[model samples]
Target: MTDTGQAEQAGGLSVVTTATDGIRVLTLAGEIDHHTGDQLRHALEVTGTARPRIVIDMLRVTFMDSSGINILVNAHQTVTEADGWLRLAAPTDSVLRVLQLVGIDDVIQCRPTLREALAL
Candidate 1:
């Protein structure tokens, strides 16, 4: 199990969860750069421990560097390996572009909204 700690990191991003219809929805706000990526990773791991399905709400996010994308990919793999699924919701264009660039758009599930992701 990974250490689950929510500490403020770079780009001023903060991660928090809201549950709806058996899905863990993690809302990420601010920029998710290299330093802040760790917080994202921890949030995913923490959520994955309690739920079988994970939804990450990225609408409030303003930017995401490659490191941020990497954390998402790693979290996806972690959830799948745990016999669960991870979905991304409402990613900003900049973050979406990074995910696409890393070919994550093809591997991970993404939805237009958090409600859609929770429904899935």
Candidate 2:
């Protein structure tokens, strides 16, 4: 089994993975901002090397700002360029609104759940 890279931190945030079939489900919790964006990017970079479809579970993300959105855009671009996929799962209403206002919703795929993302 390929070791899936998962990030878990005490205070800042955490990302947990649950894989079934070939899809990788990454669940995020806590804040996503300038302070934690780089760390999140690094974790994704590592996982990206494996070329797995990425479903980012954001149901627990309590806060997210432009920096977080930038990180998501970067990841989406990177994965697409690599012929992989990146999808957002269960974004908070606030995050969803921000994404809509910023027009990122048109570019990145956002779904209600990881399973839904993978099916698409």
TM-score, one value per model? 0.84, 0.84
Compose the digit string of candidate 1's lDDT tens values, residues 70-105: 788788888887788899899989888888888898
> Alpha-carbon error at 111 in model 1, in Å?
0.7
For model 2, state the Cα shift of residue 85 in Å.
1.1
C-alpha lDDT (0 to 100) for residue 31 of candidate 2: 89
What are the lDDT figures for the candidates, one per model? 0.78, 0.78
What are the per-residue Cα lDDT tens digits for candidate 2 across 44-98? Answer: 7734266657788888988888988898888888888878888888889988898
